[model samples]
Target: MHPDGSIQAESNSSKADRALFNSSEARRARLLPSAEKKKRRMPRKGKGRREMAGSRHPLIEAVDPLAEIFYRPRTVTVMTVGLCLLAWFSDAFGLYGTKFSAENGVKRGLWALIGTFLAYSALYAPHTFMIRPHPIVWRIVHGVTILYMLFLVLVLFLDADQARHAFKYLYPDLGVALDERAYGNDCRVFTPENTSSRFANIMDTVLDEFVLAHLLGWVAKALIFRDWKILLFLSIGFELMELTFAHMLPNFNECWWDSWILDVLLCNNIGMLIGLFAIQRREKYGNEWVGVSSQPTILLKAKRLFLQFTPETVERYEWKMMSSPKRFIQCMTLAAACLACEVNAFFMKFVLWIPPRNMLNTYRLFVFFLMVIPAVNEYYYFVTKTGKEQVNKLGVFTWIFLSCTFLEFLIIFKFGRELFREPWPPLVKWSWMAAGASTTVALLIWTVSRRNKLKTQ
Candidate 1:
């Protein structure tokens, strides 16, 4: 009906409208795919909430992946290799002995100072570079450092005269008792007329120094455990241990009153109570330790400033509260291990004919304490996080344990001529040891079972 040109124009307009509609539909489809992609990539809020809920502890949140790597078995193996090489050279050649001469004492003192500084620097320097994963590890290391320092101070006191002489040469009127013979001479003051008095004095001294100190140590253990029942069990179990082993060591042979009253009731209980009080206080108030920058107010700022001036704060770790029963058990088990360790020190010195005051004995103790920190940390990690029952012990702990047992046997066989002269009746000693071990295990199991029952109720 219309002209040919008008028809063509109408057809072109229809085609253009259809093309635009197709393009709009394609755009809508493209946007739908993009929206779906976004939903898939984004994490759901509920999932995030669950992940956060899973790890509730602040300590767990603070763990560094790098620290976990550094603490791996391979790294520990390498460290063990290095320490072994050092031990071999030191023991075989007596490298340390050469530094102890009169002429070299001044040099030795200087070197000792430098060596100590370097050792501490090495310990602390790593912290600056790396974030410590385990707070307990830091605490253990710090505790070991304190023990080592205490041992060194005791040794210095033992050789007070030599130390004083050395100091006199360096500076006059130091007025320090380098060789006072306070402990050694007083300890050896034995007489026939004063036999009863001497024995009483020895009892008193042992009670005050060793027994009381250890009882207090147990109290510290209880504070760490934060449970009264476990504390009671540990206190009793340790006494039983002493009783069981009394025949092996003359030192453990004490009067009943001395064992029960002085050791258990007075020293042990007091220490445990003090530790308990400390724990309660800490739990109620919470720990107040803050980083240097975070300390508030002028007074707190001043306190932190003062702390920096001394070596007191150098190895300090941020204190944390432990809640898990697993953690509590781990701590107690480690403490038990430490008891064995302490006994090892005594046995090694006794069997080796090395006086307790000897430098070698002091050095060994210091070294052992230093080694225990890393060892215990590794042990705690393996047991707790890794779900491992048999944790790898640090070389130092293993060495100390083996050395103690071996030396004990060596002394019994070689030096204890009279003690072993009479052959034991069939199965007497072995039976006694077995009975003691069985009793210990039974008591521990009963105690744990009772506690669990109480908790459930």
Candidate 2:
């Protein structure tokens, strides 16, 4: 017998007593909420935010219980509510517009930007209630992407002038603005005098808006393709693409030096190198997937928040290049898709007649850039991981992106009938160049793969 008048166990382990105590504790823990179970000791007066495990401030404590139900931070909920109120009050106060006059460029641009922001912000509500469980911003971004794709679909039906009118209707400033400077301005045409001024011409071209635009395009392409060889092929292919379509699109016609040296060699290669370097840096350090949810530090959380604007992962893509018939098909398809994307860029500008600097153009380009990150990931999976029929099921974003690409072509074809009046010989020649270039690159990659395999063996 124990001093407390309880029966003492005979065995040294006291197994029965231990089990009874554990069961009682377990029952108690089960009855209590997690917060109560691991309740933190309150800080005494004069203490300034002392270290305490699992301790939250009274404000945080009150908010967290409610936040758990919504799967969002209290701050996000509060900001969303505040922003909604602000937008509503602003509209009521006639801040966005005094009247519904379509001619007012300021009103139109303001309303468009405000409306888009509000619509995108409103997406958080549905995301909270209906969308799959994810970070609120992530879900909102996905919603915005869907809406953007739908917008592209709607645009596909509108004729060229109608589309320009649509842009003007949205923002009166965005009339069919085109920079009409002759691309082939030098009539001497590669004369010794002209050739002597090549270096000066290169310098002048470097400062040109179009040159910078070309570089920017290559940057996006490099990030998407993630292969120097592939990007090089694309750079040359796009120059040929420009030459092929120059008759239809006046902007495509540039001097030979401008096409090969300035655009392709200088701007495109530099942009690709920059993009590749950025990617390499990301891979070198950012591969360790520290889930945003698990991070507790404020700085890390902020970093994670910024990263929502970028891809979640940065992996080096390896193309199998002719490893098998399926892979060969995928390689060809990738090249074709890239070429289509390039063509879509130019035609979108041409068909819409929106200057590169126009806000509408900028917005579309920015959104499309965001769209491509997901599309590239999905395309890679479809091409490499999945079987034949299985590859048919594309990710949501990829499907929308492909639809947009096709619609862009459709819009160009339907509205720009006069543009398509170019002779078939050029198209045939362009097709052959595309095929030859892609084949040569594919074979080079195949050779590299085979050599590497032989070395491994």
Candidate 3:
């Protein structure tokens, strides 16, 4: 009986040992390899994890280059080329009959073509070369353009007839008829009783003309920044700018409710917001700008097909959000540009005696639209890209600016003959001019200072 009891205890001990061995083997199997080995196994995942850990956010994947070509820069190029082609064909076909004599026609066409070629070469040819200079040259070019525009404006005041004649020679079909008798009292004078009508007219002008212009501006901003915040800030800042300059331009001065509540906060601000929203939605949803055959409904598919005909290409601008100082300066410069453009438009019209819907006005506006794309693109590349500055000034802008300034001068000299006859209050005129210059300088200095501070930080 004692022998049997000792054998049973040994058998139980053996069973316990086997169970312990199995438990230890299970724990060994569950143990993980070192992190280094894991990283080696999944290199991409490891890199992604490291990036996320180091940065504030994960990096976005690169967008396709083809998708980006549809946006502003390329579209503008396509449009300009199309226009030039159309103009060439139209000239060949006599679609718009030439108003000039045969000898004049040949001379004018040759000169205009030469001028355009020179302008185009100056603006675009530098980029082809391997070495790029700093943007200071481009800025100088822009300054020249501005000076030329001023010259055009001066010419308008000095001799409207000469300005008109020049246009006639350059673009005979679209030439201005200098005979005031032929135009026949087109300029409608405003009166106290007609104030309401004038105001309504201005409102219509803002909506029909300026709204579209502003929308285009938003599109330009979108193409440059690619981010919503910058667009919104710029749009808002512009309205403030108009307000600041209101005292100088009667057209700018408006009812408080109209200027602030409606114009600034509502129309301009809402337009900007809408543009930003569209950009964000496009980014977030991913622009699957494909064909509409996959649409659930035939009607929807048909609508999509129509849209495809008017397809707008999306160019995703890769943006690195600028520091506050840089942003402020950029916004201020943009506002100044806008103001200068507006002033040019008004002064040109006023001095030239050209009605709003006249061919001259239309041509000016169209030419400006064409010029802005290259100018903005060159400006952006200079501002953001490293070691790329020697972009040339767009020929159209330079020409327009010079021509407009000359026209303005002609008008001032011609019409203001009686107004300046007495030389009344030279001090006041000097003071006003001095103030404008000072303001411009101050804004520029502030911008540079802020940029420098941001760089140091």
Candidate 4:
């Protein structure tokens, strides 16, 4: 067993292992439940984490448990041959430079692009991050991350107008100028004299389409943090962030009740409750993975199959804010990163002239949700690791997330300058500067105090 409660299975060497090739996702079947009460340990356990029995890539040496038969080494022979045949046929027919209707060409190009991405996902995509449900799912996610990064790079080359115009190739309806400021700037409270009408207006604002999005987003945040304390910190901190940036981003201009009551009280609380419920339920499982073929009943088989979508093992978190100086910094950094991601979501749509309902925004947020599953797990691994583990580098998902965030900032900076040219309000500017300085000074003071206490001990 690895130190973090995950089991590693050997290749098909033993008689038991032949019926099981289930090491892909840090999960193993209870194949030999009858063997002994005390299980045998890996020979390499004493060698430490530094000498993990794999190449530079973490899973390069591990085999997929889902696939039954495979070649000695991984190869894309099928894709190579198919590509060559298509090339030869297109060359012979002189269709390489052929042009068709914009509609037909775009449709075919989009299909081809999807096919290419699938092929890449299957054959060449990195599968080093998430391995739950299946490795292939995470491989597809990695491919999407790469594609999104390349897209940002491509968009960066075009001017704001040119970039927005290019959306016509895919999203033809987005040719119009952006209309920012989703909610109106009416920050009025419930008037006691006119309670009935004001209550209806508040309900209308609270029950909009975006409310569902907020609920789901907070659910994801709850899953990432798991700890209620951290979740509460992030939930409250994000609203404060929206307050700080309300002057700049008009959508951030929400009523006091909308920000504190509806968002923090309603959506955030409910989402965290749901997500934390899931975590609690997951912790109750005994980590017993019986093979599908061994199931006795059809209903049980369906249940197991559906449960495959869940995690192989539940990892508990202890993200207390005042744990240690390093722990405090890590927790705050994670909260800051989550808040930055939230801000960037709205900021990107406004700057790129993309409508709030655009599929681009939806897919971006969905991919981010998928990416964070592994990113949080990876970050948790980094945080809980001891000196014996020697985990000096960030995992693949965290790197992908950080890279995408940087690219997002680049895109916003490149394009937003042309759109939002107004100066920041003086109060907003001074408040942000003071907040930054105070946070820095407080952190330094806390760290020094902790260091002195440790020395006295």
Best by TM-score: 4
Regions of candidate 3 where Cα sits further than 4 Å from its true position: 1-161, 164-237, 240-248, 281-327, 386-457
How do all models score by TM-score?
0.44, 0.64, 0.44, 0.80
How many clashing residue pairs, candidate 3? 43
In model 2, where do residues sit more than 4 Å from their true spots?
Answer: 1-134, 176-179, 187-200, 286-313, 386-392, 425-457
RMSD of each: 21.3, 13.9, 20.8, 7.8
| Candidate 4: residue 445 Cα off by (Å) | 2.0
Order by TM-score, highest first: 4, 2, 3, 1
Residue-level lDDT of model 3, residues 73-119, one tens digit each, is 23346448756874774486677775677876677666665455444
Off by over 4 Å in 1: 1-212, 223-234, 285-298, 305-336, 356-378, 386-457
Q: Model 1: how large is the Cα RMSD against the reference?
A: 21.3
lDDT of each: 0.45, 0.61, 0.46, 0.69
The better candidate by lDDT, 2 or 4, is: 4
Candidate 1 clashes between residue pairs 3 or more apart in a chain or in different chains: 160-178, 160-179, 161-178, 161-179
- Extract clashing residue pairs from model 4: none
TM-score of 1: 0.44
